[model samples]
Target: MIFEDMDRIVFAGDSVTDMGSAQPVGEGLFENLGTGYVRIIDNLLAACYPERKIRVTNSGISGNTSRDLLARFQRDVVDLKPDWVSICIGINDVWRQFDSPAIPDEQVMPEEYEQNVEQMILQVKGKVKGIFLLSPYYMEPNREDAMRSRMDEYVAVCARLAQKHGCIFVDFQQMYEDYCKIRHSTFIAWDRVHPNRVGATLMARAFLEKCEFDYNHGNGEVH
Candidate 1:
């Protein structure tokens, strides 16, 4: 309910947000929104708030780090002139460090990651109605796990930036932490990064909770 009628929201980040969405920008009809939380949110908005007529756009790209997002922020998000924007990046920033240790350039260090995200927030802070700063997560439940621990640092960065910029913070890492306790992360994502439908649904629910969506609204009435 935070969004008003005809509000345009753009979801920007990496493959986690991308899934299989159309390149450059994805919106309107068919699978252009991809098969991720963005699509589910689009569906829920239409189903629960038929009168709002909110528009959701996907600006995520596969294999992108915060650096990549910052590079395209102006073109993919700012130029689109969205009323709201959600950014969920940084996973590849840490993943590259572990997966390809030899490539220093591919790995975006924490300081740079923070800077990139902050630049992005600054780009649209006053222009957009609001911003969603979603934390990058690793599905591993163990706090001591190397990747999970490193991911927590990035989550902390997101939290800090959200507070500094007065943006709405959606802690996807914490959301996954609680859900992973109930069911193994493997049940949600085999690779613990790219989530299947079940994981995507959980993500969509988490996002909607922050937006004050009414799950039971219009249940007995037809659209």
Candidate 2:
């Protein structure tokens, strides 16, 4: 119950966070929240804490990097005046380095990525009650994998910033790494990026854990 009753949380990130969420801003009824972890989070909050009535907004955009998110941070995040903001970017920032190695301009280096994320934290930390920094992940299980290894660097950056800013940090890379021990990455995502429903649920669970979500507590009863 880190979040107070009626507190609004805005989730900002790339396609993993977007997952086909409504355009511009995703909130309200129907499938506006998309089918990703964001939606799963909304469902869990409603089911587990109906009385809290938290407002969840999705501000994720497909193929966006840290640079892109920072560009729209004001309009998409700050303007919303949310009580909490959860950022889950950096995947494409690392992906572009591999998928489009030839396009040097398309890639965001680690230094710049760190700066962008840090800048975001600085901008919103004072405006919100709490901030959640979700590390970007590469679903590959092997630590020796080039992409996975490089992604680890970004994950460390997020962890470092989270600690410095006193924000809640969710290590999604580690989460997937642990899950891969029991189930292969392909079982959840074919490309190891965009997750299917199963993978999304795993992410939702991890996020809820950080929020101190109680699945068994409901209607004045703790199951």
Candidate 3:
């Protein structure tokens, strides 16, 4: 029922989305979306509702920022003509500043990040059945000053875009922070940018929580 028999799901974003697929650029069918959130969603759905037969694709590229996403939106995302699309970006918009000194923070300011996300949303509006937004996150179980200050702006822009465009929003920032209380940020992320398998699984699960599955209508419980 969710697919009307042939629904296609596509994920668009950065390295977190790009777990470890063959084409790091996210190409082909099975290997297209890498093995991150997209593949996880595929496995869960296949297990929960085998009859639904949802098709998933990943177009995530490693080391990408919102700006980079916007540049490849047409080729990597829109052209796929997916039934559902989820956008997860903006981390690099903040992380690069900490890792790469030559890169200026202004290049990915909250304002600019907002504009890029807005543009991508506009491109996918009406073209896909649903659009999901995932906020960029940083975990400081210790609540480090630098991490909080930088991620604050990036998270805000993601929230603003989700509100303005009426897209399903996943708070990776909040989720990571919550998880940090139980485990060190380094355990989930090495340099605090790229997520290890555990972190990626966490993100994938969070995204599915926001999906409106048709099977939920009978239980009156959100899917």
Candidate 4:
């Protein structure tokens, strides 16, 4: 429903999305799109809606902040001419605070986070059919306390930006937190941020609920 037309879909973010996907820039097959949630999404679509030739691409890079994603958005995302783009970021925005304490918050303040996302959204608005804004998150009762508060502001920014732009908002943070209540966070990702296959499956399932594609392919009835 988000992207009305069956056009190219691009997934952009950090290692969570990267998941060591093939790098289309260097070789072929379109960044492999990895075996992450993005790939899970593509796989389900291919299996069920075989007629929908929607090419899925992943431009996620490990250890990348919003700045890094924004810098290459033009080349990796825009150049693909995607009909829809899903972005999950902000972990690095907080991680840097721990790795480099001297770094000022002003550099990655919530306002700055909002600005970075807004710019990316505005740039891709007209060309793309829809945008999916995914919130960056951390594990509940994280071992790192400072990292928790720092990422909250970024998450708030994501929520606000998604609302402001009328885009689909997927709160991976809340989703994973709830998942932890039923199952160990490690059931998904050992670190709780990067996902294992089970975690990736959860994400794919969540997306499928939102995606108005198919029930079992040939049935042609919305699930």
Give all candidates' CA lDDT scores: 0.94, 0.94, 0.77, 0.76
- Worst 10-residue lDDT window, candidate 2: 214-223
TM-score of each: 0.97, 0.97, 0.87, 0.86
Q: In candidate 2, what are the lDDT values of residues 3-64, reduced to their tens digit?
A: 77899999999999999999879998998999999999999888887778799999999999
lDDT per residue as tens, model 3, 1-223: 3443478777888888877765534544665557666676777676666655677777788888899999999888888888888899988888777778686853587778888999999998988888889888877644457867778778888888889889989998889889888888889877776777688788878877776544344353324
lDDT of 4 at 100: 71
What lDDT score goes with residue 40 in model 3?
Answer: 68
Summing lDDT over every window of 10 consecutive residues in candidate 1, give the lowest-scoring window: 214-223
Error of 4 at 69 (Å): 0.9
lDDT (tens digit, per residue) of candidate 1 on 123-196: 99899899999889999989999999999999999999999999889999999999988999999898999999
Per-residue lDDT tens digits for candidate 4, residues 94-161, read 77766777877524666667788888898898777789888888866453567776777788889899
Candidate 4 stretches with Cα past 4 Å from truth are 1-6, 24-31, 102-107, 141-145, 217-223
Any idea how many clashes model 2 has? 0
**Model 4 residue 4 CA deviation in Å:** 6.2
Worst 10 residues of 4 by lDDT: 23-32
Q: What is the lDDT of residue 216 in candidate 3?
A: 43
Q: What is the lDDT of candidate 2?
A: 0.94
Our model 2 lands, by Cα RMSD against the true structure, at 1.6
RMSD, model 1, all Cα superposed?
A: 1.1
Least accurate stretch of 10 residues (summed lDDT) in model 3? 214-223
